[model samples]
Target: MVKWDTLARPKEFGELGFLDTRAMNTVLLAKRTSHIDGCEDSPCIKILEKKKVLERNFFRTSHRGGSQFWQGLQEVKCWYERGRGCTVNCGERVKFRKDVWLGDCALKTSFPYLYQIYRERQCSVADAWERDWSLEFRRNLGQEEMVEWADLSGRLE
Candidate 1:
């Protein structure tokens, strides 16, 4: 009997590549997500944006009492944020700590201590730039922190 785990493995390793239902759902709903603002002529999108969901950060915004379709899209948005890292083409939309912009890893994941002390954790890259990369802390970093900062600073572009 073929093991269930083996059957679900990626196609690269000779196992059947099972369809990723969550990923598929995310893609299907992404149509509505993308059209939220860009297509200004859309009445539905305009209406939705007027409400609590889309006025600001759509990814970080909560969608507690929306319709099933909207709730599904919100879930997809959460999944996308959790599973992927982004390359910075423009600093406008990407969150400074939450995105993988500086180098290989997300700043939050790569530097938890710094993130904990960060004054502008939710700021975007553009926002950070406006503030002059001034990530404040309560006290001076210790020797280990200095080493870590040096390493990460070198890696940061």
Candidate 2:
């Protein structure tokens, strides 16, 4: 008997090509979420915005108090996030430390020590750049932290 997984493989892979509904639904939802912000003319988006359901960035929104559809969007957001990278232009939408704009990974991952002491962790890239990338920390830096700070600054330069 042919395995279900084998049957699901692509025709190019020498198996019967079967579309996986779960993966397709996940991809479709992810695509929808990714483009929803840009679709300003969409009536559904307009309604959600009017209701204040989309006050915050859709991906960052919590599922609490939202509908099952909102919860589903939240659930499928990870798929989009995993396959996405941000390009900082005005930087209004991209999170400074959390987004993968400057490199392959996030600044928080690149500079863990600085992130731990950073006061404005939620600030966007535009805000950070406006402050000349000189972010406020919770406390004074020691010698090691000073070196890291220098390295981070050098990257910006």
Candidate 3:
């Protein structure tokens, strides 16, 4: 079995790295059609859906003594909370720094490998020209030709 956790860390942390939900969702869709390996209707997908936490607009509280407390709300963008699909409130905001935020879903640190796999597969498909060319060249010429030109090429079967 593939170690998915190892695939979902930040690149600098030495893993494949985390990716946004849009890319992750694409991988889930393609997995249904057998395009990728290691994950298929996996538990991690459900875990991600169930535990998706969205950061919302921050409400800042300042004490009389100059101490500041930042409170983040659960964004109103979750489908379960809103009873709709892909609405603007689906938890896309995240506070990255003291007050700065990101307008995208950040996967929890635990599932970095799964996210990495998703990202890698999406990138590969998006850049399929080279992959397709290599596959075709191998099919037409020979395995020897493929070996000479490709770095790590091989058939699924």
Find the candidate with the highest lDDT and give its number. 2
User: C-alpha displacement of 72 in model 3, angstroms?
Assistant: 24
Tens-digit lDDT track for model 1 on 1-157?
9766777789999989987676677788876665652455687666777765567656767868788887987877755565455655557778988876776668877877766666766788887666656556667887756766676666653
Superposed Cα deviation of residue 68, candidate 3 (Å): 26
Total clashes in model 2, counting residue pairs 3 or more apart in sequence or in different chains = 0
**RMSD each, Å:** 4.6, 3.3, 20.3
> For candidate 3, lDDT tens digit of each residue in 6-119?
666679997678665555654444433221112334663344335432121212212123111101111211221122112222223221111111122322122233333232
Order of the predicted models by lDDT, top scorer first: 2, 1, 3
lDDT of each structure? 0.70, 0.80, 0.30
| Position 111, candidate 3: lDDT | 28
Q: Which candidate model has the greater lDDT, 1 or 3?
A: 1
Model 1 regions more than 4 Å off: 1-23, 30-47, 50-52, 83-90
- Best candidate per TM-score, number? 2
lDDT score at residue 12, model 3, on the 0-100 scale: 98
Model 2 per-residue lDDT tens digits across residues 49-124: 8978898777677777788767777888766765567878799888898877877778887888878888987899
Q: Which ten residues in a row have the lowest lDDT in candidate 1?
A: 32-41
Write down the worst ten-residue block by lDDT for model 2: 35-44
